[model samples]
Target chain A: MAEASSPGAPPAGASRGFGRLTIEVRRSVSPQLRIGALAGAIAIGLTISAIALVLAGVPASDLAQEFIVATLFDPTNLKAVFVQAAPLVLVGLSAAMAFRVRFWNLGIEGQMIFGGVGATAVSLAHAGPDSTRLVAMFVAAMLAGAAWAAIPAALKLLMNVNEIISTLLLNYVASDILLHLLYGVWKDQDGFPHSLKYSASELIPDILPGANGGLVIAAAAAALLVVVTARSRAGVYMRFVSASPSVAEALGVPVRPLVFSTVLLSGALAAVAGFVVASSQEGRLTQSFYQGYGVSGVLIGFLARNNPFAAAIVGVLMATLVIAGQNLQVFYGIPQSMVQLIQAVIVMCVAASDFLTVHRLHWAR
Target chain B: MSLPTKAVALAAASAVAWSSVALTASALADVFKIDGPPKVAIILFGPKNDGGWSQAFEEARPELEKIIGAKIPVVEKVPEDSSAITPPAERFIQRGYNVIIGTAFGYSDTFKKLSEEHPKVAFLDASGITNGPNLESFYGRTYESQYLCGMAAAAASKTGKLGFVAANPLPVVNWTINAYEMGAKAINPDATLTVVFTGAWNDPVKERAATTALIDQGADVIGQHVDTPTPQIVAQERGVYGTGHHRDLAEFAPKATQCSSVWTWAKFLGPTLESIKAGTWAPSPYGAFPGIKQGGTDIACCGSAVSEDNKKKILAARQDIIDGKNAIFVGPLADRDGKERIAAGATLSDADLWKMDWFIPGVISQK
Candidate 1:
């Protein structure tokens, strides 16, 4: 539905760029077109990454093997991808949940650290029976994460302090606390800067012979999130809040409580990620385990448009890229920085495509 | 379970474990043997050209290749996390590589687990703490070379005040600090060595700030035990002298670097790899601690500032250390608090060196 003042000529109110071109905000986009645009964006990203890798001296065949065959067809490599993806999926969901309510939640790493510390504390204390130890650790991790997250959320709500600054700064405080424990009280018998390894009972069990339980837990969380965000009454309220906070409040939605609860839930999810990494990947509370995941979580949420299922897919895709990056470095001696550069290029390309969904370019006479 | 109950149970389990261990003592000393021709692959914790610790290993790669007569490929910037370490290491093993070299203390646990899972593969880690029959963790007696660098720093200083930038108060780092102080005092009796811990291995910003602060406090020469050459670069910028660590800082600050305590990993690893190939490799139970004589670490000494006489003196001291005539941590050592550390006529043991937490006289630092 073009609004033109004159039939064969440009309107007086037309944008003056090139005296003929105009950008029109789309009132609605068909689901098919939206999917097509997203698919095209992802395709462009992959093509760009593939070309960059080839130019970086990775043979095209090897690139395919590393990116697809090794990661997907090979069972062990696939397991490794899932092992990495589980934590990423939780972190992505954590970021997505808070971001949907207009909160940055940059303190995901900090919350994760607190979660790990809390789990380690439970193990060290031997707080429950063997059957209930894991449950206790999980609950403690979520609570710790929520408590850490509460600081920035409260500051934003009560004192009107910027959440971005508070959340980002709290990461440093959490890091110092982690180091203090690792270097001082919680150090292992070997005097290393890491907590003691957890007992067998403290570790996340394998769901099957070779399948990691953390992956199952993460998938369940994602599925639950899909249901909650799509079907629940709170989900409807959340959508209203996201659309327009003032309007939603005027229409009787409890905006503050919704935002506060969402942020706390986000923190709890991130903490679960930390617990998964510690229990499933590292096998102990270790320094530097939480590194780089915050950025990955935010990026995954953005790419998925804060949709839980899409975030899960993007998280796995990200894990695949990480494994492939390691392979490129191991096989071709490409520096990690180059791999990071390729990833940045792909993310930028996909992000630029978001513009296509929001507006349409019109050719005016 | 309750805490006390858990502790009692743990103690009982350990006592039983120890008796079983004693019963199986004969099996404990079994020598590790490689099954076939050795294929070496290295994992670096930082970039290959990181200018310090990681670069030291990368520079040694060519020498190792020549010794093994095979290419030694490396994966750089691998994090300390097991998830990051395991895939590349497993891939290397899958590809038929038998020998894996890890270059971080953080790699200790993963390397230990990998060594157990693949008993035929030999694993060697630098600055690591875990060792098994098929795994050996090794570190240099860095204090030996740092002592020599100290002499050079003292010789170069206009005033008798020296400052050191260190990573942490870990025993290995502390030993270097004490040795540097001893070496400086040997050159200038009244030299007071002040230390500032950056609490980081490779933060150049912190290193620069610490260097400037020390220089402002009348330290004419600066020494560093941190990973970067930032201290040396800052010394050059501020028109002062500094000693280096990991690699030759003269590469970065040619004019200001009086001496550098550099890792000679190739000199140490070449023979170790040869022994592994020859099936005579017996990894130490307590990890390898090679000194300058065994080529773990040595110094690049004497910038233009050091007088010829001082250079000769430093070289003679180096020769004495190599000949086992001069042990830096030998008896009559005392902490700055007037407390005796090493009693007279007795040398500091390797275990004691590793647990060293107190400073010798002339060394100052924060609590």
Candidate 2:
């Protein structure tokens, strides 16, 4: 409560001066206020991004054409957006699920890497018939991701190792292992540092003429997540664990198994993201396919406030930004750093809005 | 806690809209032809001012524009992924671009596919392996220029121990390491070259650590095949001599850089575009490998550290390579392991060059 005091407020045990502003923690925040705060943050983020981009010499008309018409309306680019968004949706849901259990799953990229490797392994080994190869690859990817996620979860449970550090450091280990395979055994016939391209039958088939299978898979996953969170007994248990672990433990919730399982599910979902990314977008297990996704997952989780439904929306928005950013670069010759900066601004602004949800500023005497 | 039926509907709408996109990509051209006036564009694999590989193309754009007599716009930071490469490329094509230059090995497959999809557009990629009827991949024989830089490094070295930083143990990188050693040996017979591969192209932190480690190991000069000028920058800070790759490193580290293996894409690309405009272009099925003779690459030679006599020798060697009187990889060559890599009275083939995994004597590396 003392920490919530504003900068100009008097220190503890002193008389507060008139017109001195102070912040107080709210007992509960109304949903309407939460929505209003989010809307305000979005407005600020968009306005700032617009001003920055305009200052950088992008015309307002062109910006609209690029972001709205080109990214959202153009058939080819919209398809590309769908392809890009699929992995983002899965990773976003995964991050949200882990965050619900109060577990910071920074190892999203590592699990993704293992997932891609496992899928590629299935394809390379011809593990199943041509018709069933894609399914086999998907299964392998999920298992691999879960296995990778188990490491950090077990360490956190057994030795109380800080999951944040372990998960973050494991990203490098995953990349190195990926490189090791690419540069060694998995190198293509041309000696490039990428695995052989998957056979067409092993790749994600387009559900519609141009609609990739990955998007459907991602949408279904998001829907499944919504169901699991709202309808399942495990969902209620998870809410208890999220509110307060010790309290939940005293209330007879199986905290350890719940946390572990949630983390594993998160890993599996992230791995599915990798599978889609490789199969649908890259067409092969490439070194950099998993790049930038770990941060994107976390950003989506933050922006969506760990809600699966909101995550799907945020994923589409981010995918739109990516496509539009590419258009801006292609047309205006703006640097990628500027595009990334706009994304950072939006994320930072949205994240800052969290402060308003728990506290209110008031003038005190 | 609410159902996301609205999100599912949105996804379904987006998916339904996708069906409007036609999947009718076919290669119908027997000979590549532009339907309108030549319009050229470039797709860069990194930022325009990345201080290395991509910057070389950015620097070449104006010169290429002059040769083609039209503005050659560029899109930078297009990654090697198909999804990333496609949108910019398709947009350029839609806006009537007839010629597209790509700068990355990763752009190969996409370029090939795009070339087939749009036969009227001529495609070219640097360091790419793929080539087709409407597509050609070209790369400078960097080993030739690096050889000269190696001589310069050896000349500036007080310790007779030189270091090299590279991205990968791939043939392209390994060839540079070998050529650098060969060039160093030409000046100082016993000058040994130690190499460190950072496993990434543009990682400055790793490049800096590798450079510092080499300098600490008594290396007086450094050479690099990595994309960044970090090795040269580190050398300058450490008061050691270095040779640069991609672009002239003297721009970043004037004091310590003895010479730089610089890409002369303008010289190669200008003529290629001219031929392309004249409808006389015939892309090689095996891709183009230009050397100093054709100006694919050359050296920005002789910093203050290199003696005038050594500078003369380096220039003379460059001239010999240009005149086809000398080959960097020739007969009597043996690997560091004392295994014969080149037989007597023979020269290394281009195919062998691309598959080069063995290093010549006096070249040391972890690989």
Candidate 3:
């Protein structure tokens, strides 16, 4: 195991200002165990998934082929998976940011939906000869997403409300709003409960020939988050607050404001995911558009242990499973729901591995 | 031998023959009946109100119940995943449902396995390929109706180019596209058809995108095999003619969409259920020919967009099909590679039509 610091010298932060506290914190984790723990967890998770597939009646040969095909081989199928994963990656980062500070913002899905509705409303309202109206719609989507998230943030900061419950409950409210738009105001005049077709002027120009621009936005956000958390003073403060709220307060960190900002930022990022999905993927609001990306994002964040960069990778992997599962269905007649079972297994394995990494195991037998 | 002894022997032999016949008849009539009303279970892959395949099956449930005088229990929005299908089916079978209907193609394998395990339960699968002593598969001849829609499109088109937006390029989908092309060519020999596969069953955006691309490519008349109204909406927006599949969609684009191939599943379900009740349910692998004559596959009420002349032509084409004067997959056919599928002037057999997997001459595959 890698030592916490050189034996002859005091911990770097200890001499600088924090004293013994920095040394104690540095000594807790060994570098060698981190990689091993992650690998072991993943292996266990895959084994569980394989067993579930067997119980589900999928032949072992077919399951193996599905995993291989999902990881590689088919680009069109792979593209669909990436498209599915893109939203989750963004929302997962949002959850990770708040989670690092021990703040639970379960309302990421609601924020995303509101953002989508906001963008759709703006696009529909101002659709015409002017191109600038499209830009306005994008801005409106982001603002609405942030505003929707801010409500819970305000509630948590002022009234000391449990954000987890409030945010989770808001998901239904946001979904109801979406239904209202589809069924009432923006409903297609054809009598079907779908929104009217979005005009060409309403769509955002694709960043790549075939890719959605929103994917680029998500990537940029992930990169920015990594840099901020790794190099900025605010990140250190957030870590301090997360580790010990009392110590953070004694060190003069504005705990309440910091919490409020993190929650708000988290919501805004999640909202962007929703906005992109609505504006680019479906164009018009339909009840089936969300496809559970919000919940999947939370799962990915948990698997990544609240690391934004890691969440992105896990999100992509999750999406790959979906695409691969569908392909397997087409090729081997396997059910696509196998993807969900695989996801559950991976999450459990990762969680268990993390536990083992943190604690020493004893053999009783 | 004594006369009294001989008469006794004759009477005993007569009794044995009569009893044998009676036993065989009773064995043939053997049916598993439970106390109270007959329980029927319906499993669906999506919501009952999806306005698609599942919805169509759900609509027939009430009519079926009314016919049988029994309350039917439907399991709606069931996952297509095999893992979910088996457990739910086992539970339903344990509860003693006499009949189970699976309404999706993916459920065929699971239903087949379960049917074997519970031989007393009659299994009816829609859009699946399974047939056993207790399991039967049912599908309507949807391609025949799609051909009529094609005639309407060919007559209504101003550009002489027709478009088909398909969910996937499977053999089932190929039947509809081929029928449309054949019908269009019968009406207007110069007509050209273009088909695009969106690689999904229920993505509205992809469907719309494919429709728009087809319209931009100078396709003046459009038809779609998707489960949503997006195609009709797109056709209406582009001011072109359109046709629908699986259900009536004229209401979605009354101005641009004129007709649809509506499925009437109740036509077969009512008779099939009666047969089951009478203890005469036998596995019949023979496919049902649901043409206009049977009221199973119907051309929905045409919208005002269809002209009287076009309607007359469509009706004439339909009559020809009904009278067996026209065969959609009639041979003398050549695939795209110019290799003869059937020798020139040779008609295709029923087996040939059922297993068709190639594109005809003049059609381009986007693979």
Candidate 4:
């Protein structure tokens, strides 16, 4: 109670003065220095991208223009990036949630695939243009995703199985299952080894005229996550567990259930992302679908420092890089693999800068 | 709480969900099956919307379906990767497909294996070398059409230089380059043809870059084997003349690019399907030389930029090739190493033509 009312203990003017001083201090840091740092990071990323392009026999000038068009200039390309980023943000949020409880739910990809499969099954079963059916399909998708995640969570809790290996292994199994559905029983009777076209009844209706509605749902989920983390008892307990598990135990926090629930939530969220992509864009599940959303989500979560809002921005940026890469391929003679190199460079720079945030850079000489 | 109890509940719920989904799909299929015609499958390497080889296949699908009186099931944008192709082919075979067509050169091995495994199913592969009792390989002689385009390029060029932009330096592509050079030299003995290989089958950007570089180097006329409108667009922008390969690109840059070596796949597909339906699909390595007479290879309508005299010359050359007055591959053919590949005044055998891997004189290797 005293901690909550600490603002009253300090005079209002003093508190206001402190806040003003903090802002002033931040402002005093040269804007040029900040811009320079960002520019340096971008330059390093471009250098790596350029090297890859040259090796791939594409000219560097073409690759540079592609980066510009993808990130800042083209509205259509920018929208494509945001649409791609939406799913990654959800998956990143899921990972961040699990990380908060020190539970590594790496099987987010498998869970998402299972979720898509479940949603697809529901859509196939209830073929109609009813909103209720769509809602039911989404719910089933979430449940299926949660159930897939729960397997690893339960194994970690009860059988002492390491989640990293289990989750990674499950990805292959899930992929095989998807292949089986596409090639075996669910094969399109029209002779192609592809699933039948999903009807309008199965689709998640668009949020706006152009953008996917899933982005709105993902943003809401992120906002809710932030509010829960900042304002709720469960959120506080999660933070406590993350900081010191022993201390949380002493404070009578139920560690096992917390870990289980958090991981489950993470898996279910990842699943929803998969559900969105499969239902919204593809309308049918393919073996190569969900191309690397899970792994990319892990990178996004790291870049954002597990901040849900920041993860959304980072995911959008990553998506922009991809679209821009394709544009570069179309407009210029730049290879698409250059985008992968840029992503790798960004990840490295972000990781390096994270160290700089905590420690000063020094030269021994 | 307990493991057994949780497992039981999970199994029960999953079973319920699975059964419900199965029942729904079956019911929907039953209702739709009676109304819709039986579906035929068309598996291709790229997207139907890509406006290239896959698009060509897609265009031919509806026509084939119309002839067969069946609803065609098309799997577009399928990857050419081995891991994707093998399983998908097996699945099609298992699903009792009447005819399975693979429209890529890479699917040769897979189709051969599948055809051997499923003898009853007829396999048709485009640009593939696979042949079996139930499988047939079909491809057109693109070099003959390219030769006619080459004559037009040479006759129309202000500069004595012509360019050929190819996807790869493979035998099939090399043959076009060789024929183009031979035809050009036949029209203007001083003409030199520069050839640049982009090392990709569908990269538009590289094709554009190669075209631009050649144009800058004073090559007034160009031809491309790449599958995109980049070359045509590039030529239009630079106020130069170019010829199209594969499908018609006159719509892409109608003013700048005059005439195209159009490859109509329907000519081969119609006969092959008829043969398949009649149970006479043999393991014949059939190569069609569909020139102007067959309408498989024809000079597209020339743009306004092309002069009347140049158009007449192109048409005359087309007639000469169709009437057998001019032989594109009649050799006196020599390899890059100066070895006599085709003896003087002797026509090359089919086996020799299929395994052509050398560049002719005046054609530069960009590898």
Q: DockQ, per-model, please?
A: 0.58, 0.54, 0.02, 0.03
What's the ranking of the predictions by DockQ, best on top? Answer: 1, 2, 4, 3
Q: How does each model score on lDDT?
A: 0.89, 0.88, 0.72, 0.70
- Candidate 4 on A5-117: residue-level lDDT in tens? 23334322234334421101121334465445545766777677678667776676665555675345645455566566678788888888888888776777898888888
The numbered model that scores best in DockQ is 1
Superposed model 2: Cα runs more than 4 Å off: A1-40, A352-365, B1-30
> Could you tell me the fnat of model 3?
0.00
Candidate 1 segments whose C-alpha is farther than 4 A from its true place: A1-23, A29-36, A361-365, B1-31
Native A-B contacts reproduced, model 4: 0.00
Per-candidate clashes, comma-separated: 0, 0, 0, 0
Candidate 3 stretches with Cα past 4 Å from truth are A1-365, B1-37, B286-296, B344-347
What is the model-wide C-alpha lDDT for candidate 1?
0.89
| Reference-based TM-score, model 4 | 0.49
Cα shift from native, residue A276, model 2 (Å): 1.3
Which consecutive 10 residues in model 2 chain A have the weakest lDDT in total?
A11-20
TM-score of each: 0.92, 0.91, 0.51, 0.49
Among residues 3 or more apart in sequence or in different chains, the pairs in candidate 4 whose N, CA or C atoms overlap within 3 Å are none
lDDT of 2 at B216: 96
TM-score, prediction 1 = 0.92
